[model samples]
Target: MCGIAVIISGVRINLSSLLPDFLSPCPELQQVDYFSIDELKAALRRRGPDSFGTKKLILHSENEGRVLLSRFHHDEVDTSAQSSSSLTPDYETSLSNQVNRFGVPNSIGELLFFGATLQLRGLNPISQPLVDSFGNLLVFNGEIFGGIHVDCDSNDTEVLMGSLEKCCSCTSLEACHCGGEGNMSVPELLSAIKGPWAVIYWQNNSRTLWFGRDAFGRRSLLVHWPNAFDSRFLLSSVAPTSLMDKNSDLDIRDGMNNLNFWEELSCGIYSITMNAPKADGYLAGEVKRLDWANSTLKELVKWERTLIVPKPEMQVFKEYSLHSNGMLPELGPQQFSASMPAQMVLSALRESMKRRTIVSKRCQQPVPVAVLFSGGLDSMILAALLNESLYPSYEIDLINVSFDNQFAPDRISAKAGVKELSRIAPLRRWNLVEIDASLSELTSEIKRVTSLINPAETYMDLNIGMALWLAAAGDGWLCRECNNDDDDCERIKFKSAARILLVGSGADEQCAGYGRHRTKYREGSWLKLNEEMKLDMHRIWKRNLGRDDRCISDNGKEARFPFLDEDVIRTLLGFPLWEIAELNQPSGTGDKKILREVARLLGLYEAAVQPKRAIQFGSRIARESNRKNFGSNRAANQASAGSVVIHKPST
Candidate 1:
């Protein structure tokens, strides 16, 4: 993923002015001082490390339409580790109190797009804020995996931009003759494109601005909708560190509640009509949501899939019947029998991983793939499935981290998982990169990690963010002896070179992998469990994915969740609850039972029985993590183990 942002307005908001004191109640009108274009670029710098580009498009309303006043582009190759090479920002349209007088102070007719690129495809890098023949501009921060045909060796951003340009009459997403049968709109074209993405489109002809994330919200897109005090409409790929302390009285926008200054724009396509009168000011863009192709499906609650009826025929396990007492029949593991549901899951997962990992790239190292391995069922299964998808000549990296000097459960399980993979694919080299960090190391980078996971304010969020951020950096020690023995092993500092990291994000939500799922089942049985899982799947993007994508991409590596594939989701939904999981059974085999069975089929016997362990807890990073923020872990743990708010900076 790349870092992309867009700011739209007539008059520029001068955010550089420093206020002497918090003298005024209406502070959003005060200054653009916090998140200037340079600052926004800085906040997103880490996510894209190859090229830095900026575009300032001047829009003038005319009798014909919104005329493009000027189009200027500055592109520079960034060789520094931090991509610190700067391109001058030209969005210096005069600021005025005209916005309040005419409509407040603002950058009204001027639109600016700033992008940093982490080039993943094509022989040459593509500088973005990409424009086409018809003047439609796009800043795309995502991969185009499926929807419309993109050549395996093509650049997705350029290809996607070309496809968008063909929507000639798409002022409203009602009619277009591109990427559709006869007519297609922005939402129609976008809905077809599979994979994770967030985009900002300038439909120059219609004076319409189109923006949205994939239905799954796999990437981060933060939106600060226009308000009375500020006429600027902003959409950013980063919310990590921008603006000042958002909770401060000085930082509050006049109309919106202080708590939600910036929101993770909900997934799905949206358009803002920009043809309103000049007096409209910040109110110019009238936003409207485009419905999904399947109209019967509730757009708001997409998880409630009434169409996906269970396929009883797909369940091959017949003997582990649940007795009336809510207990599984006493039987050995062998009696459970091989299952079609497990096979279906494995097949779908293999295809999902293949689409994510097998793509155009810059280099061919010995290792091109890595799994965020904990050696538990999900990670192990992903490792095994990825092994099947990639060639044996290419090595695989299993990055496992521990804050406790490698004694954490994840480290131990990761070792065991490697051994299991060795048994199955002896020719494949499994690099178990051990990432060890101390409390002092975490403390040193706490502010940065905290910023990266902004909008997510909890002890658990911090712990997980820190772990993933470090792990994605892939800086760790490699055991030369293939990690068979923890001690008495030769170690060398190593970092994984793989650009793609496969993670099992959606497995738990679909297969009852959490303790809460078990709790919901015990409390209200299957129906309750199903509802809880649906809720988890629906909200996982907000609670988990955005933060994960931000942290992982900051290291210039894309995190691919095979289980979260649309097909994988639909496939899992087709199975009956019993086929998905025999929750009445024990923990290791019951929770995420379908995944456990997949592991078993992959010959990962040891890993198939290991219970779920979250990244923070498994890595022991959660140990005393709340001490710095909260008084102790006690208050947070007792109330809502992972939901206690952590107050800090801008993110």
Candidate 2:
């Protein structure tokens, strides 16, 4: 994780004096420097604190003055242990081999710098990939996930280097030969990757810069072109406050003058400027403009389905059931079975928990990841799974934040759930913190930071605050419990400080725990229930990639839904709907029975079994807050309505 800034001034600006202030550790500034690239690198060092590097380059163009700056955070390459010379041929080759081993291209030099970090699992390395061949310079924020790959024999940088090499070698032999073998366009490369990303790629030859966000805005990248003293474009992870000099005659009242305006409109990676002549506008503007042509909502959905849905070859349950023969009923329309015993269901859940924790263990961070605990069933289950499977290897921190207001009905239940989780997983490993803030105050704070109206309102603000608190405690990954539903998923504030968030989505649908399934079952419509379940799953997939994922990305955190893991979903799909329905019964006596049973089998019964309370209900956010302040403003609305009535009062 790092902070990056670049200045492409129309004229030479003296940035030397401003560097120190930008780099200084200031709490108000989010420990990021506005003027100094070095200072920004230093601030990022505190986050990774293991390895850090800074690079700057000056690009002289016929039409634009470009000053490029970058900062990097690498955990594997120890900064204190090794010197700059450690990036030698043998080291680079070894890294290149690792890159190729992952099936990526070999692009050397700057490409190596960018590509090498991409292979590191669970790290978001902000980098710029520039190629002189296409006369393009590109910078990107957010993780591409498994989007780009190169052969083990090569890395991205190497492929780029090879292309450049071929271009140089061919040009030397034949002056008339146009650049082909060695030149790869940014568009071509971007289309190949599959993941969330926000990129700014500039074509120097055309004097244009292109900006775009991943279909689901996973990371926050704001563009500000202040019309104050002079119009200048600024981009940053947080708002750029340093640009607002006191002397600038810009009216802050217009809202543009205030740095807060930029934070309010978190428009991820949209181009703010395109310098194209009126007559030849299309030609120069074509490359630099925000190209959503490749990023339509439909296209993104297709890409998402391809990446998330598992192949038939990877279906574990189908093979397991097949081996069990006709004894295990076929998982189709005619094969509905009665509810399984709680113990049997618990066994399956334990296996799922074991699998997800193993995957999470691959994170390179030293500290155990934290969970944004809400005392709800989803989060409680997640906490339990981690406790049983990942406790010894990684320390699990539980951050339980709640609002104390008239809105809370189950406040006691929330507290009890927290105590229960601690009891089940030992307080020594789980540290729980409770926050007391009015919903109104939290709403104001969220508005102050993000500008946009949080869909979850105060609840969303509390979640973000909890994430920031966890980040402060040296935890970069904070787990959240967001089911696959659009509403549940919408509550996630991706712009929060946490880099990765683990969500428990898809479990309910796969397990037939949704209300729709119950309705169908009550109606004695098993076929309808099965169809509704499939439809729900499809909806989950679409909503995650389309609405929820994009919203989270806008906040800069990558959301990983362990429940949505193809293997898990496939297994749950085979289970009988009656069994699932019985498991999710809202009995006041205990947790959701089936899920708890599964948890119990995995030795996580205590964690998995919690009253099935929705996150919003658990957080105590007023479902009708939107309508609460309505009557207070009724007189004003009536006055305005009468003013338009054009009639005198009948006094």
Candidate 3:
């Protein structure tokens, strides 16, 4: 849950101006020579407030590389470099008053890694920008789940790094030469994990830098080339257009093409070599994707895949095929029972929840956890499972973030659902924390999040980004300080008790919850429905996960998706058409029928059958944003404004 930055340039440009000076207002152009690493660190302080530092390395005589790391302020800083006796901020006490402490970049070798860790166990020797014994430097952002067999004590990133090394048969960084043989390739290692991450792996021996997102693309890595027509590159978790820069490719003043020079790294593996380009000024090489269905790690030639650096205007690719690729391990080739889809789903979800909650290595006491609860079936089922779990020590918070609007259906639904569940699951501590913000307040948050999400090409995308931004801002909460007895008392405010938020993101895609799925079923387009399902799953990486990651991680809170777990997907994929959608049935009943049944089994009768509603609609944020953007004439302007069309399939 931190921000990571990497800037590589063949020439010695102004380090401060090398990136957009967006963290805050900057001095006049010629006033400063080098950009303050602290300022760059400050721009991303929200990502990692507990600890922030930067590092630098000279990869080539003329080429310069820098890495920045910022840890969440709620977590204790690693004091190995400082005195052991010195007292640091207490994580518990600092939760409400998290502060930013900026310092000079901790000069390391030829690489600088910056990001923060939410896990208590991460404050140890293997902190981050961790260089393996082989000299393979890793600046990883996200968690790696430990399924049934892994040791509980090892850090997810450390274990993943070790596993990658073992699979590749690369004893040292020098062994990973372009043509050198290794047991596995980068894709093979990536295929084996079931977590969300964005990583930058620098191969010291090859002097090559490899970067990519998890199959889900749950984290972001934005790279900007000052001269789109050159090899100088700057990558950051935050949007690079926060402030105007003299060397920027964007025209920040006019705000027309600020993103033209910036692009998000797509959801696939890519490698960049240090060799000089031949014809085009752009780096030469083909970006290779692992042929999940055919390739193995043994064929280790130097990665020659040219990087696919997409333009800011182009829609991102949506082929994050986990099953076809090795993102999830191959399951037994047995058909699942048509009538028992609910049973199978329950089993899968139970296992996923168990695996996701494994205590970190250094965690000795219970910490507050949360669920991005919408009171819908997907979220309700997830909450029900957590309530039923044995982890009673944790205070489970139901975070329902919404905006002030015509009718707050999301808030109303959440309140009703939470009330109902509390009676059924009386043993669990399910505190409902409602975070509501004004449309005006959220407009700025939306603008801020846009840098990370890039501008939404469509109005629908903008609504989703705004809703997500409000949820991530951690700005509003229920006012607990007010007197309940007083009718006029301040009943709602802004506060959060949890550092981890669990979401049911993948359920809808796997179970055909979209309105289009119903239409496909009515038209007898089972194949099309299946394809759409796959497409949604694949597109989640870029469309939903990446933007969601930026918004939520901004608060230093990590998001976990049980529905997106490997085992859960496997079970869902095994289901026959009947479990996904019934051909002749009504839209709501047929769509996500299996998940509804599971919800019933968990005693969430109301939520079990609740029809699908996009977050923007359910939260009423979309309606409000339109009201704010278009004023009283929103309806009349719909056609020209590109308002989202809602389809209501016949029941």
Candidate 4:
């Protein structure tokens, strides 16, 4: 929710001279006129306007002093609730009080207490405390979800102090805060948590730093360690592209200095360091090292194998209800009903639209948001919802990017459908941009960008290219049609514009739109499929869509999936899969049957009646742009390697 930056040096250095320059573009910096430690502490506040906090450490040196600054934002809380008086508390009883109040889990008490910090915005702990029997300091980012607990007895700050005390007792005197116990180690703690996280801990007495991230790699953390100049280390959510000194070209023998590190795309929890090169400069020495002293592949695999089982059936849907602790309500069985699948589809679609439009009311002007429209069911449905909702008042725009590939199936008809929908929603403005980029041209680009090792890589490159095109055309939020039942591999690579990208992800799964659902129902295994299959399906859907969030967010854009809404999900849960399938089946030459029925009821039958074409197929994004482009039937294409065979145009 907030930006964080840190600089740690081996030798004492004055950070004040550079503080002003760094703080200029960063609005979070407070006033720090004096060299006093207290002034530095006062100046280092959290960046998020909605919440703020500061922590400072002064390291004594032979000359000047080295300083550390930490800041955080409490994004989940309301601005009005963040009062300084609420944070200031008596130190003695704070830890116990916070533990009781927050219901910190017993197993995670030591770790949570060390990094615990009060979130001013939400009046909750922004970071968990890292505590031991003695004292330790912990700093963590990302959520733990259903993992360990720390005593929330006091405010966040106090709990951290308490945890630090406990950890300091067990480890070596210098790094005692890391603790001597097995469960308290970084690897052990990571194994116990179920969600993404990046954590750093320091033992005040031991003078050591420990860093770790979640196994799934959902969050990004970067580090820079220069051996030649000061042996300083820096870590942040942003990448390390700009960490090196512009003027210095000195080389270090260890290969650890003046280097930037990032993990591979698929590796989990891979930690590498930037180090110095060997004296020979022949690339013989260790340039970087993985921090595996506390990690073991065997243990990680074992822990990962125990995946969480999903819930059974669609839970009843709750409306506008918050959890007892004020957290967002988790989707459960009680939130859905057992109804006809077609009705469920309609209900889920409406709910998804509602959630996607929920935005903070702080903007002076209506925010500009865009949806990537094609003449397809998903995109059309999303557009229809936006046309009626508060989204239109926010100056919502629709951009449909397509290519004029002759080989593509039903291209003309699809374009006609989009035109028809545009007329139906005449009050809204629509931009239909068409391109004729050749397959040969795209293939070269895909090879350049993806380094194409797999079919999945090729598809990802195409999506990225499409996103870049949309980004170039406008600055508003851009969304594409993404359904939960779609391939996971595809979801992992989907990206688009907008601070929040909206996708109709969960609708298909909840409403039984996938071909697999039809096969299962026809096979007469309804009882087995009905038990908790919906819950299991949702879990997979969330995980896949989550990858979309990570990939897009890596570029500073947030993704919002309206179909993931609890209301929509609950409605879909009540229906039978067969009924939903029938509604979606094309009626004669008409589009998705069930969606059209519901859209008609909502007075959007014209917009909804368009045929349901998958974006890749509809837009010809997946096919080559040449006459030689052939369908998946490779055997039939043996005699026509270079000749294109276009699909017959639909009526």
Better of 3 and 4 by lDDT: 3
- C-alpha-based local distance difference test score of model 1: 0.72
Ranking by lDDT: 1, 3, 2, 4
**Candidate RMSDs in order:** 6.8, 14.9, 11.8, 17.0
Model 2: C-alpha RMSD to truth? 14.9
* C-alpha lDDT of all candidate models, in order: 0.72, 0.38, 0.56, 0.37
* lDDT tens per residue, model 4, 1-651: 322334342221112332333211111112221122222112222111233333333332111112222222121122322244343321111111112122321101011111222232123434333334333445555443324453222232333334334432223223435443532533344444543455555554444445555443444444443223233344443332222222133233244332223222222232221111122111011112123233343343222211112223332123212211222235465643333334556665665565445443333334334455554566566766766655444554444444444334434543554556556676554433333344555533433222111111224333434433432233322222432122331322222223434444544554444545545555645543343345445343223333343333333333345554434444443333333345224431222345555665555555455554544455555444323334453632454432222222123
* Worst-scoring 10-residue span by lDDT in model 4: 105-114
Clashes of each: 16, 40, 30, 73
Error of 3 at 360 (Å): 2.7
Give candidate 3's error at residue 531 in angstroms: 2.7
Candidate 3 error regions (>4 Å) = 11-40, 61-112, 120-126, 146-150, 163-185, 225-230, 241-256, 276-339, 361-367, 405-407, 455-457, 473-475, 479-494, 633-637, 640-651
Query: What is the Å distance of residue 92 in model 1 from its true position?
Result: 3.7
- Give a tens-digit lDDT track for model 3, residues 240-301: 43442332333433333554545666666655544332222212222233332113212211
* lDDT, candidate 1, 277-385, per-residue tens: 3433332345667766535223323665332223343233232232112233454546644475688788888888788777455656677878998988889888988
